[model samples]
Target chain A: MKIILKNICKSYNGRKVIDNLSYEFTPDKPVVIEGGSGIGKTTLLRIIMGLEKPDSGEVVFEGVSHEAVRFAPVFQNTRLIDKLDAPANVRLAAREISGDAVRAALIALIPKEELGKKVRDLSGGTQRRVEIVRAVLAPSDVIIMDEPLTGLDEGNARRAVAYIKENMEGRILITSSHSDLFEAFCETLLLK
Target chain B: MQTLSLSAALCRVTTSITWADSLKNGTARKILIIVFWLLLWQGASALVHNSILLAGPYESLLALCSLAVTSKFWLSILFTFLKITLGFVLGLITGILCACLSYRFKLFREFITPPISVIKSIPVASFVIIVIIWAGASSLATVISALVVFPMIYHNMLSGLEATGSSLIEMGRLFRFRFIDKARYIYFPQVLSHLHSAVLISSGMAFKSGIAAEVIGRPLQSIGNGLYLSKISLATADLFAWTFCAVILAYLFEKAVSLILKRLSAA
Candidate 1:
């Protein structure tokens, strides 16, 4: 899909956080948005995810723009409700995914031992993976992940990176702290 | 001078403390306390030397026993119990309705404040008299009880509603939860403990005010009416018995409500 994020200016209080910036993210391959903290990398991700509306400018996905495109976001923090268990937390968006499908998806990403435990009980790495699986399993046109590799040790991060590479269909846009990951797997779009 | 021995001190004491002696078996301790109080009453009645002034514990117990055998006693208890319970239920409904309506409309809350303040500050006896004059003796007690209870219920329910978390509500909105689903998941869970406390408090108030109404209104076949007659006839034993019965009924209602709350919390 062709995606364009044009003149995306955002500000908090009186200061400019995202200045008049323009970029395009499309799929012949995966794209990474790499930038420093307080450099509007997260703000840019939020604008693309439609979680925030810009002070000025537009985000267009497949030429339809923010008002048109169907979107899903895997947030930086694993925002699982404390009350629901691991499988139930993931199933909130994709209820149609059967027990076996949930089981299989969870088993593929999360260790089998942590499958039955609640998201709150699971370690940070496992919760991160569950959130990624939840995003992957959800039915969405564009999957946007903000800081998706956070908290995972290198081995699990690699496993998750591989899973996303294999399973993504339409488009993958990720915001990250490092560009080396972008170099190895996808084209890098540096935001300074 | 040498200090008195334990037995001499015990013998010289004017009063006994039974509650401290109450070990794990609370019921037995209560019985012991009752017996102690009964002996005290017996001793006091003997010292006074006037049956008109004070009836001993046995006299009250005998009165209660005799009253138990009579149909009027049962009828009085049942009628008073039903009227008070009904008043409680009505007050609960009114409180919840007022709370919800007040929350829904700011103007209504402002309008209600003056009257609630007036009711809360004024004496129950004043309300009882006013209601008796307006509604007559028979219906007055129930009305008084309900009025006495409304503020307690309404304020608690309002606080409960206010305590509902904004974040959880936002989550519910994002999830597109229906009104029923929102209430079940978000509204009820937050407000339940509050409502539970309100119910317990209001239930006790209902009994007290209901009986007080009966006393003032003189409703036939009610515990309050029995109390009134006993006072008129100088039957101190009967008065004590009926008052004991009222206390027991109130205790039982509180216990029953507490049990229900426990079950609800468990669920």
Candidate 2:
């Protein structure tokens, strides 16, 4: 599938974060958006994910319809429900996937002991991993991540990226990060 | 082998933490405090000496025992209990529904806010009289209870729904979660956390207002009627006995509602 962003513009309080930004995304080619803080990397991702409307212009998917594109997002922050356990958090988004499959996927990334603990009780890195597990386990045509590896140590970040690459075959992976590690696997989209 | 020991250790730690929390505010201490208050009341009543002015604890207890064996007492208690509970449940449901509607529509929220504010400020006695005039005596308690409880629950619901983290809501939206899933996994917990305190405050208010309405309206075969008759006959012991029953009923209802809400949130 080919997804195109055409002249997309977004501004907040008279400051333009996204100024006529355009990009093309393909299923086989992973896109990594790199920018400093407040340069609208997350905002651009939100525009693509349809969580926010661009001030002008459009997001067009040539080969695929809008409804056909299911997004599994690892938000910039670990947005897991604090009241729910790690496995339950994953299972919430992965509704179409079998419970056993989701549980197995979560148990693989997170420790067996931690799966039953509330996400709020987990450490920052552990919680980030759980969010990754949620995204990976979800049934999605596009995996949208905004700074997906923000809280993780170098080793865990590498492992998380590996899990993403291994599990996300045939799925469009659009991730934004300040880290250069994603540059190895993903085509770069730099924003000023 | 290592995992087993770690799991056991976690269990022991959590158990100890729970034990500590309970000990800090234990039920035994609560009972002792209640006993102390009752003893003070008993002493005060004995010093008064006049039964018309103050009934001793023993006299009140005897009056309660006599009422217990009588069908009239049970009937009146059941009548008032059912009416107030019905009103409470109705108020709870309506408040939640209104809150959700208001949350979704800004215009509706604006439209409803002023009236709800007025309801909140209005005196309970005024509501009881107004409701008695509008709906008559039998439905006065139900109407008054519902009126008393609605604004409180509605206010709490609004704050609870508002308190739901925007970040989690964004996650739900991006995931395209079904309405039921969003409600279950996100909204329910957020709303319920605030709901715990709201239920505690409103349940007590509901009982107090409901009984007050009944007492004024003189609902047939109700606790309020019993209290009225005791006052007229100068039966101080019976008045105290009936008041005790009202307090016990209100206390039990609050406990049951709070317990149910806690269990639901846990589930």
Per-candidate iRMS values, in order, are 3.8, 1.4
Please provide, for model 1 over B1-267, each residue's C-alpha lDDT reduced to its tens digit, 9 standing for 90 to 100. 135576667765623444444434666677878889878989999998776799888889999999999999999998888777777778878988999889779999999989989989999888888887887877765777788778998898888888987655543543344576566656666677788877888888889888987888798899999999999999999999999999999889889978987887655
Candidate 1 chain B, poorest ten consecutive residues by summed lDDT: B14-23
Which ten-residue region of model 2 chain B has the weakest summed lDDT? B20-29
For candidate 1, what's the TM-score of chain A, rounded to 2 decimals? 0.90
Q: Which candidate is the best by lDDT?
A: 2
Task: State candidate 2's DockQ.
Answer: 0.54
User: Which model scores highest in DockQ?
Assistant: 2
lDDT of 2 by residue, A124-158 (tens): 98998989988888888889988988878888888
Give the CAPRI rating of model 1.
incorrect
Compute DockQ for each candidate against the true complex: 0.17, 0.54
Clashing pairs in 1: none
Model 2 CA deviation exceeding 4 Å by range: A63-68, B1-47
RMSD of each: 7.8, 7.9
What lDDT does candidate 2 reach at residue A80?
83
Q: TM-score for all predictions?
A: 0.71, 0.86
